[model samples]
Target: MKRLLTILLLTLCVNLSAQTLRKYSNEFMNIGVDAAALGMSNAVTAFSSDVNSGYWNPAGLVNMEDKQLALMHASYFANIANYDYAAFAMPLDHDSAIGISLIRFAVDDILNTTELIDSEGNINYDRISKFSTADYGVTFSYSRRLPIDGFNYGVNAKVIRRVIGKFANSWGFGLDAGVQFESKNNWKFGLMARDITTTFNAWSIDKEEFAKVQDAVEGQNQELPETTELTIPKLQFGIAKKFIYRHDFSILTEVDLNIRFEQNNDLISTSVASINPAFGFEVGYIDMVYLRGGVGNFQNELQIDNSEKIGFQPSIGIGFKYNCIQVDYAFTDIGDQSVALYSNVFSLKIDFDCFR
Candidate 1:
């Protein structure tokens, strides 16, 4: 049964790779950064206004009061994969800001077993080796406020890199655009168009390294995989409002609609597109301590009894700000309602004003 399963999985992977345009290409970038935003289920599109705004909605960078630096790390898939991120942002004059960010997701020490059995049909443990698979993204972002008060726009130029040990690698490029508007009543609205130019990755494979696998599994992987990959566009729209009372306490609430052109298992699915809605809120005291909670990833999942049920992911987090430094932590998949494993995320942010 184990061998049969392995063969079936290999076939499915090969068939899926035949398509040049993938629905989830470069998906590691979508995992998000900053524990505060992840805890809010990535619903901060409207009010993401720090160094991390370079990844969430660049337009929000204009709200920064000083130069800032951000860093975050998270573990996934039972610690098999490590995700790391860092960013820096500074105001360019009064009306504009610029930032750069880097992200890496990697799985290290993956076993290579194609040569486990030698040509003499002898089992040789020494022939086994280990390699790693990693993906990287670098983004340059610029944001400027418009002549009209409370309006801003931003753009991002992104470069993507992927590596599969010595077997294959690829480079990709893409563009993104974002806009934010604030109303007189303090209502915030934002729109983000990701991969506006459609990202493309061209791979180069090592035929010699791949040849060993072709003969290891007869009739399987006989041909090389596709060399090109395309990532489609996605849109996120958000709105937020903050309610303040008693001078020192406030609550900020936000809602976001994430749209994809292809139909899938999202909550609002159709032939042409699908919409996933996320809702989050933060309670703050004296602008120093905060508590956040959110729910998202709504899906209609198939059950064992041939039935369907609604499943979602929930996250909660806390944050503290002191002088020019901030620290945050989040606990995701609180109830384990979804199929994905739970994760604990942590992040730190510092403002340059402290140095001066």
Candidate 2:
């Protein structure tokens, strides 16, 4: 049983190493934040405002009216994994704003069964241990309105950290930039470039812990795994329009194009790049209640009969705002079209003006 456990662990490590090499490393950062945004299927690049802008498109931070704090939590995979987010943003001056945010995704209390059997060939339950694996990201953002009317730009500096129990850990850094513009007719446009410098994570493995599983297989796990992982750049472009009716009801519609450099299973693929499109809309009454819906993540899936078909994800959410507090809830999927179970996300935002 001990030997089998060791082999399984070794295989998991090897698979993780391969996944890191595939250019989409550190995927936890892409899961997104804010239930309001997720409810719209992450089609908020041009529609984001306030504190949550720190994660979506920092350029929208310039629209913040006052100091604010945001918090969110979601559970996935039958509550085995938890995702949490927190952010704070404040206006620095009439034309500028600054914000900071943190995100964590973790799975806890996993049993370490590789040591279940003692070296003397005796089964010992006391040798078993528990450990957790987690990923963290911290982002610092700054936004400034350009001299041109209705134009704003922002930049982000990110620090990434990952841990796999006591076996390995990594630290990484990256940068992002974004811009937003509004037209006279309530039209909005946005562009965001993520990992513009190509994020890199440098891993350090604990040799003593890893050695226990290094020889689990006869001809595998002989050498240390790759020491570095790289994440390539991706781009998002968005457009939106807002309409008001009778001064009490309003509607907002938006469309976004997500671009990846390499060809893949996206809806529109080519050798140079692939494009995935998202559409979202929100209906609001008296600026206090909102209903949101969206469709995104278009992909090509292979059917059991060897045929291919297109698939997409649909999401919906609602929000209420009164005084200086706002609460939002969303029902969405953490996975692609293949996912059977959906995740429930909730978020809260508080504006500091009331306290002052």
Candidate 3:
């Protein structure tokens, strides 16, 4: 039965990959939720050791020494959207941990307009409306240290929901798995498989209401259809090393490689160009003040026009920790030359065990 389940999971992933093609579904899942992780260009697969580890690599949850609660918020695309996350984690036993997290991404106060016009050719301002679009996800994660000295394994189950005003909505389910290994020399290696079960979203549309609006508007032929969308699986591998100097200062560096399998004319390409790589470095002083920087999303061709091209996205962040409370901030470049296009993330965490 175990082998049969594995086969079914692989088949589902392949089918989802074929259906998604070049498009990404449930893309909000890709957004980094932790300010500290974002500051490191999301290269924390092997460097996870905090509350947010549940989102990066569930196996890393085992590294926490006590119960933790964390909260984060970010503004994206010039304040057009807001993203927020919250999580709590606790050790279940000597060798195992459990965590739960919630994520919300939303765009509010959007102007909704229909073409219900008067016979006098004047636009009816009263017919205009306002609505909001939002996406939400909740994840439950569990991790355990394996019998092997420095090995750990973890899994995450997630439920997702998306709403577009009152016109359409979708619900989805997905699973993720991860493993981590630590060497005696303090080197860490991590592997994560996201959407291993082929995340599936079933969308329901209000076609009757949509049809009424279409009829009110002249020359409108758009129709709504109920459909299901899939989010393909993605794999990530990472390595990290840390250096401690005289117990007063420490430096850590990590690199992560991400792989996405997409079908091109029914062929899968595992070439170098298809792999996305991210790099990060962190410096800590007296375990209080921290500085971080990294680069990622190396796009070969990000064209503003026919001649203008941009390269990879870069990020920097700072952190401070005092007692059981920690605060982190990160700034990410979103590829636009305009300053308004940048994103900012802020996070706070508290550990209850500090007082124990």
**What are the models' TM-scores?**
0.94, 0.93, 0.86
What is the TM-score of candidate 1? 0.94
Highest lDDT, which number? Answer: 1
lDDT of residue 337 for candidate 2? 62
Regarding lDDT, does 2 or 3 come out ahead? 2
After superposing candidate 3 on the true structure, give the runs of residues whose Cα lies further than 4 Å from its correct spot.
Answer: 1-22, 115-126, 212-220, 263-273, 302-310, 334-340
lDDT of each: 0.88, 0.86, 0.80
**Model 2's lDDT to the true fold?**
0.86
Better of 2 and 3 by TM-score: 2
lDDT of 3: 0.80
- Give a tens-digit lDDT track for model 2, residues 309-352: 99898888999999899999999854546454688999999999
Candidate 2 residue-wise lDDT at 183: 93
Q: lDDT tens string, model 1, 1-356? A: 22532443363244236547778889998999999999899999998888998999999998998899999999998998999999999999889999999999998887777778887899888988887779999999999999999999999999999887676788989999999999999999999999988888877777777666566656665567777778899999999999998989999999999999999999999999999999999999999999999999999998899898989999999999999999999999987888879999999999998888
